[model samples]
Target chain A: MDLVDFARGPALKAAFIIFILGIVWRIVNVLLLRHKRILSEPRRSVPVALLAGLKGTGSRSWPHPEFIKRTVTGEALGYSYHIGLFIVILLFAPHIIFFGSFIGARWPALPNSVVTIFAVITITLFVAVLARRLGHPVLRHLSNFDDFFSWFVVALLLVTGLMATAHVGAPYHTILGLHILSFDLLLIWYPFGKLMHAFYIFPTRAVDGYVMTRKGAPS
Target chain B: MNTSPVDFQANLAPEEAKLGESARVAGAMRGFAREIGALSALRLDACVHCGMCADACHFYIVTEDPQYTPVLKVEPFKQVFKREAGAFAPVFRWFGLKAKITGAELARWQHLLYDSCNLCGRCSLMCPMGIDIAELIEQARRGMFEAGLAPKELYEKAAHQRRTGQPEPSDEPYRDKLLAIGRRFNVEIPLDKPRAEVLLTVPRTDIEHYPAAVAALVRVMAHLKADCTFRSDGLVAENYGYYAGGRDWQREISRRLIDQAVACQAKVLIVPECGHAYSALRWEAAELMGKSLPFKVLHITEYLAEALEAGRLRLRTAQVGATAFHDPCQLVRKGGITAAPRQLLRAMGIEPRETVRHIGYNICCGGGGGVFDIERAATLRHRVVEEKFHEIDQTGAQTFLTTCSDCRRTFDDGKKRFNWELTPGSLLELVAEHLQGG
Candidate 1:
C-alpha cells in the first residue's frame, strides 16, 4: 500500500480507536476503584470544597511564588511550549482541516506564517526542556524511558508536521503521510505513557484542592 | 547533655531483625496495590515529574539530594503499582521490566519513606499537577510496614503502646508519674471521669520528659474552671502505630481514645501539643475506625484558640521578648490549624515576628513524622534544621514559640546544638504562665 493510503486507512483508524478506547478505559477503571471516604467531619461544606477543587484546577496551573522565583526559566519554557503546541495542533489551518475530517468540526485557523512561528518556538522550547531534563539532577533522576520516549515521539510529530508545512524535505503527500503516521504513533502511545497527564491533570488538581480546602486550607 | 544527636537513648527496646526473604516482596506489592485507591491511583498516574516539588521539600531543599525529591521518594510505590496494576502491567511483566520490591529494597527505602520524609504535605501544595506526594509516601510507609521492613524504633514504640497503652516502656510506671505531675501542680486530674465536657490527654513523652506541658494544661483548665479530666485509660495522645505505618495497631491506638471519649461522654476531646497525635485523632481516627467519632476532636492549640475566641479564656500580656512562632507540619500544614496559634499570639498582646515562610507554607521542623525518634536520621535532621533556624533568626526574635511539643523539642535540640541564642518555648506553657487570675 502507498504511504498515504496506509496513513489514512489502517494506521489512522487503529490509532484513533486505541487512543479513544484506551483513554476511556483508563478513566473508567480508575474511577471505578474504591474511594476511601473522608469519615471525619469536614471543616467546610461540600459545595465549598467542590468550589475549592475547581479553584485548585485553575490555580495550580501556576507555580507558587517561591517556586516561581527559583524556577522562572523552567516554568516559562514549560508553559510556552505547552501553549504553543496546543495552538499549533488545534488552530493551524491544515491541522484544522484534519480535525474537520476527523470530527466534523473546524474553527477558523490561524495564518500559516503565524503557525510556522508557533511551531518554531515550540520546537525550540521542547529542545530546551529536553536539555534541562538531561542536565538537572532531580529531573534526571525522576526521568525514565517513558519520559524520553514521550518527548521523542512528540518532537518527531512536530518536526514531521513542520517538514510537511514547509515542503522542504520531500514531496508534499509523502511528508504529510509521515506526519500523520508520527501523530498516529503518538496517539497509540498516549494513554499508556506520561501523555495521559493531559487528561488526568485537571481532575487530580481538583481532588487535591477539594481535600485540602475541606481541611480549611486554601489549595 | 550529650551534644551528639546519636548519643540519645532509644525510647523503646530494639526490635529484632527477623524478616525473611520469602514473599516479602509480594506482600509489599500487594499492600501497595491495595492502598492505591482512586485518588492515589490518579496521583500515581498524574506525576509529570517537573521536580518543582524538590524546592518545597525540607530534606531536598536543605540537602540538595536528588533522591530526596518528593516525587522520587514515591518511586518504589510507583514501581509496584506499575508492575501489578498499571495499564501496561502485562507488557511490563512480559518484558522483565517489572521492578518488584525486595526485602533489601524495602530496607533501603526505609530512609526514603521514614527518616528523610516528614510527610509534611508541602510538596502536595507545590505540585503543578496537584499530586499529594506526601500522602503517597505515607502509603509507601504502610507497604513497607506490611513487608515487615519498618524501622525497629517505630515498631518497638508501637509494640510498647499496644502492650502498655503508653508510648514507651518505662520502669517507673507512667500512670504514677502522671498522677505525681497532677499532685505537683496541686490540681485535680480526674482520671477516667464518668462524664466531662472535655477529655484531655497528653502524649507519654509529655508525661515523662515534659511534665510541665501536662501541668500547663491542668493550670489552664483550672483557671478557666472548665469541666475537663485526664482519663488514665486513654492518657496518651501520641499514636506510634500511625507513625510506624501499622494500620491495625494505629486503629487500635485510636480506638482507645475513641472509646474513652465516648464512655466519658466527652463533648470535646483535646489532643496534646503533639502534631502527629493531633492528626491521628483529629483526621485519621474516624477513617481508621470506619465511622464518625461521637465527640469533637481538637488539638490543644485549637482548643485554646477556640476558648479565647469564645471569651471563656483570657491571657495577660507575656513579659517575654519578641518571639517567632514555628508552625508544625502536621498541625499547621496538614491539619489546618494555622490561624489558631497566630490568633492566640495576637490575643496575648504579643505580635509574633513571622518567619520568612510562615502559616500554611511553613517548613517542617525536621523532626515530624517520627523522625526525631529515629536515631539514624539525627544527622540529617540536625542539618536540615539549620534552614528553619536561619529563617527564625531572620525574624530577629529572641524567643521561638510553637504549638506542637515535637516541634518545640526539635527546635530546642537544634538551639542547644548550634548554640543559637533563641530560647524555644511552647504556646501551651506560655499560656499557662500568663493565664488570667480567677
Candidate 2:
C-alpha cells in the first residue's frame, strides 16, 4: 500500500462520499426506473445455456443461449473474452485486497505470475471482441456510441487492474488513484449506458423463461 | 356474418380514417428507463457480438438490410440502460448506439414491431443468448404507444376492435355470404345462435379470405352431428391488438368472446386455425375477463385430437405423402399448443417430417403484432422465410400445415414473395379433408 501517502485524508473522505452516494443514487435509479414484473419464476436459463455454451457454443449466445444458432469460432472467442474479463474484474489483485481486507479478514490474492497471464489473456480477448464489433458489417450497423464506450471501459478496467498491481508500475496509490477515479466515473456512468445490462440480466433471463415456457420454446 | 377483413379507414371521417391507426402511448420515462436498464444489466456483458443471430432473422437474410440485425433491434435501448447503470454509466451514455428518445425516434417503433418483425420465434431457435427480440418488440411498441405514437394500421385495428368486437372483420354483405355458405354446406350455420353444445369462434379471415378452412370445420361438425354455431358478436378472436401492445383493446376483444360464449351457454368453445386467437381466448381471455371461462375450450387441433383419440370421429380421407408442421408464433410462443396439432396430423396417417426448426423454434409468419398494414407491408412484412421455406423444402413436403389462420395468410404471401410452391393449410382442415369418415 505504498500510495497510502497519495490517499490524502481529504481524498479518502471525498472518494468515500462518492462511493456511498454514487451507489445509493445508482440503486435508486435502477430500482425506480426498472419495469418491475414481480417474479413468478426464474427467467431464461442462463445457467443452462452457459453450461451448454462453455465448450462449443459460446460466441453465438446472448448471455444465455437460444433464438439463433452461432458459429463455433465466434462462440469460443466470445466466451474467452467474457470469461477472461470476468476474472479480471472480479479477481483483480487490488479488488481482491480491497474486498478481502473489508470482508475476508485475510487477503488471499492471486499470485503475481497468474495475474500477469490473466491480463494478457483478457486484453487479447477484449481486442478480439472489439474487432468483431467494428469490423463485421452487421455488428457494425448495430453498434452505436455507447458500444465504443463499453469497449473503452472494458479496456480501461483491464489496464487499470494491471497497472494498479502491487509494485508493478508507478507505485500503488498513483495508479490506484486512476483506478478509483475510473471507478467513480463508472458508478456515475453506469445507469445511462449498455453497462446497465449488468443489473438487467437476471430479470431479462427470467422473462425469457416465462415467455419460453409460455410459448413452449425448446429448452 | 361479416367475417372478412375490413378497412377501418373506410368508416373514419376521411382525415381520422386516413390516420391509419395506432395504440395508446403513455410517456413514462421512469418505466421505459427501467425496461432499458433491465435488458442492459442482463446482456451488456452477455453479447459478444458474435453475429450468430443474423441467420436467425428472415428479414435480415431476405433483404440483407444490416439494420435488420437482431442485436441492432434492441441495442439502442440497451445502451440507454448502461448509462443508467452507474455514475460512471452516465459517462458511457454517449456511447449508446440507440439514440435518446424523441417523438421522431419513438415513431420508428411501429416500423420496428409491425413492419420489421412478425412475432416469429425463429431467432429464439438460434439465439445462444436467448434474447427474446419478439418480447422486446412488444416493450418497444408499449413504450411508443404510451407516448401517443402508433402505426395507422394498428390504431385503426384497435378502434375497430373496440367498435366491432373484432379487429379485422368486415361489415360488407357478408351475412349473405354466410347464408349462401350455410345453404351450400346444408348445415345449420347459426348467426347469433342461442344455446348450443359449443361456441365456435373463427378468425375474420374464415368469413372471406380462406372460407374453406371454416367450411371444412362446418362440414366436419355437420357429419359428426356436433351442435356448434358461429356468432357475429366477438366473431373474431385474433388479438393483433395484444400483439400491437393494446391490452385494453385486447381485453375488450376477449370480453366479447367470453360474453358470446356465455350468451350461447356453450358446453365448450372451439377456436379454429388462428394461433393468436387461440391464445387470446384460452390463455389471455380468461385472465382479461377476471375469471376462468364458464365452459371448457379447445383449439380445433386439440379438439380433433380428443375426437380422434376417442375413436368417435373417423378420418374420411387418409393423408398420404410427406408433410411438415409450421407452429404459429403465438400458438407456439404464447399459447402452448405444439404437439396436439402434430398428433392430429399423425392420426390421419400422414407421414410427417418435422422441420429443422419446429415447435417453439418456429419462425413467426411476420404478420403478428398487427403488421397487416399495406403501406409499410413491404418493408415490415418482407418474405423473411428462407429458413422456413428451406425447412419446409427439406421436409420434402409440398403442403405446409399449421394451426393458425394468420400463418395461413402470411405463408401464402411468403410463398408468393419467395416463389415457394408449398401450400399452407390448417391442421383441422387436413383432418377433415382426409378424415376417414365411415
Best by lDDT: 1
lDDT of 1 at A22: 90
| Candidate closest to the true structure, highest TM-score | 1
lDDT of 2 by residue, B1-438 (tens): 001111222211233323222322125244345346543344443453546667677777666766666655554344344445544465555655233544444444445445677656555545555566655655555554444455666766776777766565555645556666667766556677788888887777676777777778887777677787877775665765666556567778777777888888897888888776775676556655566677876778777777777876777545456778887776666555667776776667775687765666556666665665535665446565545677789888866787777777777777787888878877776676775552
Task: Residues A79-151, candidate 2: write the lDDT tens digits.
Answer: 6877876666666565677657557755456767686688888888888878887787677766655678867
Tell me what TM-score chain B of candidate 1 gets against the true chain B: 0.95
Kindly report the docking quality category of candidate 2. Answer: acceptable
- Model 1, A20: alpha-carbon shift in Å? 0.7
lDDT per residue (tens digit) for residues B1-438 in model 1: 000111222232334355466666766776687688788788999988788888889898888887788888777788887777776678777897865566665666677788888889989889999998999999888887777767778888888897778877677777688889889877666676788999988877678778888888888887888798877788888899988888888999889888889988999999889898988888888998889998999888888888898999888888777889988888877888888988788888889898888888888889989898898888899987888999999998987888778887888889888998887788899899888873
Error of 2 at B23 (Å): 14
Clashes of each: 0, 93
lDDT by candidate, in order shown: 0.84, 0.61
Chain B TM-score per candidate, please.
0.95, 0.79
